[model samples]
Target: MDSSDFTCVDVRRDGFVLHVVLDNPRSDMNAIDRAMHDDLTKLFRMLKQESQARVVLLSGRGRAFSVGGDFEWFRTLRSPHALAELNRDAKQLIWDMLDVEIPIVTAVHGYAMGLGTSIALYSDVIFMAESAKIADPHVKAGIVAGDGGVVAWPMAVGPARAKEFLMTGDALTAAAAERLGLVNHVVPDAELEERALAFARRLAEGAPMAVRFTKMAVNKLVKQALGVAFDASTGYELLTFMSEDHVEAVDAFLEKRQPRFTGR
Candidate 1:
């Protein structure tokens, strides 16, 4: 796969492990704009054909893994055509990630919010920095936790706990996330990359077929869950794009004020 095709994500192969970085040059926080979203979907599809890649180490550059959707980008989605494209890409990204047979190990530092949290949670294993945090704050933006949040969170921390965080759009510290069974491990901020790389290398060095098949077998259950919840949740999310409240939320966010939602 030619990494040059991606402007939002940086892809580099290190031996048997493919290192994928969520580095959006347009945004210092690594926000997911249209380009990043499409790049991610394409990247995963390419991974399926990467014969040399046995494992993937996914991370972010700069201050965050990702801070979720670019608020500026969110404004453009109010149009029906733009929203329709977003819906298609959103579903495709989740499905492609799940379909890829290679094991993905995510190293999350700083903030991973909204779609960012969903991406990390979908990984086969997660290594989070002790000072970092995760949150699916779609509700905060007056949107549904569609994407992968509805599917991944409930499976990770159970329905009750998932509902609490999802509905409130609250952030969870790495320690708290670890206790809730959301993350696989929590290392110090300084050790996060090294520890995660070691783990990915371990997977890469393992018997290739065994590792791939094991991941495939386990992901069947996730695919089943996605079939049940993903489309409906994404549909509802798209509906919110047309809501008055969603516009207010986006406007208020950009203006840096509390949104006054009237439940339109």
Candidate 2:
């Protein structure tokens, strides 16, 4: 993959590990917009096909890993064309990440919300900062967590617990995440990147074919679960993107007030 294809992500290599860092253009949260989603899909697809790296370390550039969708771009997504395009990219994002043959280690600090949480949790291993948080806030936004949460959350944290958080859009602190088995390790905020890179380097040093194939076999479960939930979830998300409650929610959010749902 030509690094030129990415405008918002900083891609670099450390030995056999590839690092992709999110450079948030619109906000401190590294929010996902259609363009970022499209770029990420392209990156993951390219990684699936031609990455020579044995491991990947995914992280964000600044304070937050990502805090979900960019509200400005989000406000324009009510159109069918916009929603449909994003829906397709959402599915491809999940599919291509799963298809990538190498193992991925996520170093998450700050908030990982919605698409951010989806991306982090789907990785092979997650190293989160003790002060960081992970959540899928689509429900709070009055939409489905269809970016990949319906599959990734349940697989990592189990269905019963998944429902509690996903249904409420509540955050799980990194410490809590580790306790719940959602994150592989939790470290001090300052050590987050170092630990993740160290772990990725360790993975890179392992017997190459065996480690990659092990990742493949383990991810087969993710692929199987995703096949069952992804289509319906994303479709339902698109449907809700145009809902009365969703509009009300966005309006209320912009107005800095609570939404009154009429259930239209």
Tens-digit lDDT string for candidate 2 (1-264): 555778778888878998889885766678887678778888888888755888999999878998878767888998999888888877888889988888989999999998888888888899999999988989887888888799888887789999999999999888899999988999999999999999999999999889889989998988999889989899889888899989888888888999887765
What range of 10 consecutive residues in model 2 has the weakest lDDT sum?
Answer: 1-10
**Candidate 1 off by > 4 Å:** none
Distance from true location, Cα of 207 in model 2, Å: 1.3
Which candidate achieves the best lDDT against the true structure?
A: 1
Candidate lDDT values, in order: 0.92, 0.87
Summarize candidate 1's per-residue lDDT along 1-264 as a digit string, tens digits. 757979888889889999999899888789998888889878878877778889999999989999999989998888889988888888888888888899999999999999999999988999999999999999989999889899899999999999999999999999999999999999999999999999999999999999999999999999999999999998999998788888999999999999999999
Ten-residue region with minimum lDDT total, candidate 1: 41-50
Q: In model 1, what is the error at residue 80, expressed in angstroms?
A: 1.8
